[model samples]
Target: MGRNTRKRRMPLATKIVAGAAALTVGGGGLVWANFYASAHEDHSGHNRTRSAAAQVATIDCPDVGQKIRDVPDRARGEVDGELATMDSQITNAYQRLATTRRAQAGDAQFVQNSILGPLKDRRKAIIDRIQLEINRAGGKADDNLDELAACQGRPADQMQNGDGQNGDGQMDDGQNQGGDGGDGNGVAGPVADDFVDINDVQPNTRDSRNGLAADGDGGSTGTFTTDCGVNENNLFNSDNLIAAPGVDNGAHHTHDYVGNQDNDAFSSDEDLANADTSCQNQGDKSTYYWPVLRLQDGTQEFDANDQGGGAEGNIGKILKPAEAQIRFVGSRQGDVVAMPKFLRIITGDAKSFTNGDANANTSWSCSGFEDRQVTDKYPLCPDGSQVLRTVNFQSCWDGQNIDSANHRDHMAFVQEDGSCANGFQAVPQLQIRLAYDIPTPTVENGQVQNPYAVDSFPEQLHKPITDHNDFINVMDEDLMNEVVDCINRGEDCQ
Candidate 1:
């Protein structure tokens, strides 16, 4: 119950293993007396043999294992064809996950609605036909569907620990010993162990005097927080949803969008300017978005997908930050420059990140219930506080353009010493800080695993690598000017 419910993507369609003939076709149930469920796993741990005889590979999806060739020669193609279709469906899921950074939350129910749903129904239909063909040919169709779905392979222990082997890849001899973990042979095989304990993965332990300029409200004369507004929990409010604004679900992934409701792939500043809002403030009309991270409770994940939370602390089943802190962080005598309309800006690539080093301008920490804030590895929040993802965008603009060729050229991160680079003029600095009420990542065999997960770029996150954010400014002419003036005058407001 503590794992994120994000399912892995398959570049091709996959199918859940059929649970042996329920024979619900007409009425009565017909039991498969040929095979027993427990026999699916051989006591000797030689699954290859058992797997070879099995029709389904895994419970979650039918493994592309051996084809059933025992059927009459004419019927073999039909069975093979059904499996091929399943593969294609699985591929579609993979494409969705790759582009959108998340899988459908319906789980078995989701499987029933989308491509998986049809796949399963078709598979059942095909199996029924196959059984009929066998009966017509005076043969028996030994059912093995129960075994197929029995081992869905979602458990952490089985995933990291192949079959039942220990960290060394060798079958556990009861000692559970872990050495340098690699086989003595110098083959480029998987390391015996690659995961780190949650406590061992502390990426940020800096006490104070951190290099970030936006770390405090030093010169802020006031702070303005938009309302917790509506939470868009359902995936893809628009066709071009998630990241890649104006592109219409271009990313193919899903995210928890906050702030302005008009934000989308094609939303223009004019759209935000005209849209009504849920926030208490009538002036804040900016749109914000990031991947939805969810915690899985062992067998399944219960998230906003099952409920309604298109608002703060609701979408992705995540609690909203106490307040969204908008600030100006940079030099130039605290003078804030008015942000141009329809400014499209992105910080950190959703599909890219570094576990050992932050490949982007990202920050992480925990607070509220937890005592410490992490800057490196995301905090395994302790006690009351939630983990926070803090991103401070480059405030030094090129003076004329709201965006650059890569959407980054116009702005540059302050120098290592926190000063604007030459030739770049300081503007009303924008800082984005999001907090999540997530527990300390689950500890399984020394590695950190989130109860929920995000769709990120890396093949494997090692930890929770789905932290990212997207923003577009839609402030009104007068309101934009006020934010700039407050920052430029170095007035602190809250």
Candidate 2:
């Protein structure tokens, strides 16, 4: 049989629809009306550049270990202080109670003393609570001491064998051996010649982005930018766009639904012009009317009116200002771009501008700024009919948007009375970047490692201290050193 040769082509309409569908499915379409461009334009007006200076330095593993060991001890100290305070308060209460009882016995018409009987009972209860807490603290402290002992034992075992090599290869036996402690595991093994000496205790050699070793000359710059908009024209699809006040066009509707016969009824500019003509012809006879148009991008546009002078048909009573915002996601490089001071919005005499209605003359015309962008010269719209100019915007420390599928990056509108900060007329895209000099982990010695190390001993033992009041708490520093010593000596420190 002859080979079949056929080329399948989709209709133009189908192709267009498919293209749009693809974009939306991939999160790359104008599903909403927003635009975001790199705010930090280089000299060529293109890409923005961010530079950071990181220092490369060694972090003494032993120091980290020590910090961890100190945590439990600190918590225990706090518990002790609290118990002492409680004791003092109880003593004072008892003294007052004794004096008040004597006075009451002598005087026939004695009033209730403010700081005597009732206070004494309350203080007694507090003292009881303190005692319980102290017991718990003591217990936790004991547990910590036990754990420390176990860790110490591991290294003692390795030291006994004279095998100075640690598990992580960063420390050796001689470096870890101290005092009378034997091999960490309480067992002896063959010692190796590679054992490090005690005097060699030093910082672990590792590269950290924020460390001084990473920052060569420290002459770096960065920039940052924030953009705010409305009508789906910014990076974020702001939630400020209000739903149409009347009935749903299709499946979505409620009791207050007001039917629009022409809903989704127009598909071209000419159709809208025709609708406008019909409005003019009906004149006063028309209770409600709308001229619909299709933009070049295929989105529907509508201009509506209610000539009935009734409450339901008033266009001026329904609209509000819409907004969208874009924020830098990560930290910038050299010459950092500071947060923006202004957010701009468009305003006009139309019933709805950028998906919001100018419902009230006063409401739509008021002008102000939010956050740190407040200033004396409040910019207003050109005609003074509405406030549309840029105003100062505030910077938020934790304002970076994290993509959690909840659309949290979207901006919300702040009402005049400050009632609902989350109330929004639109949503915007949020982006963030880590600031310069911030440390991030990278690969080292063929293994992934944390560039910013934190003390872990306190966190690990926190629950025990919280639960057992009578425990002797271990210090973070002590625990950290013990771990380092164990690792260096190839000991079985738990």
lDDT of 2 at 77: 36
Worst-scoring 10-residue span by lDDT in model 1:
24-33
Relative to the true structure, how large is the alpha-carbon lDDT of every model?
0.40, 0.19
Q: Provide the clash count, candidate 1.
A: 67
Best by TM-score: 1
What's the TM-score of each model vs. the native? 0.53, 0.15
Candidate 2's TM-score reads: 0.15
Predict model 1's lDDT versus the native. 0.40
lDDT score of residue 149 within candidate 1: 21
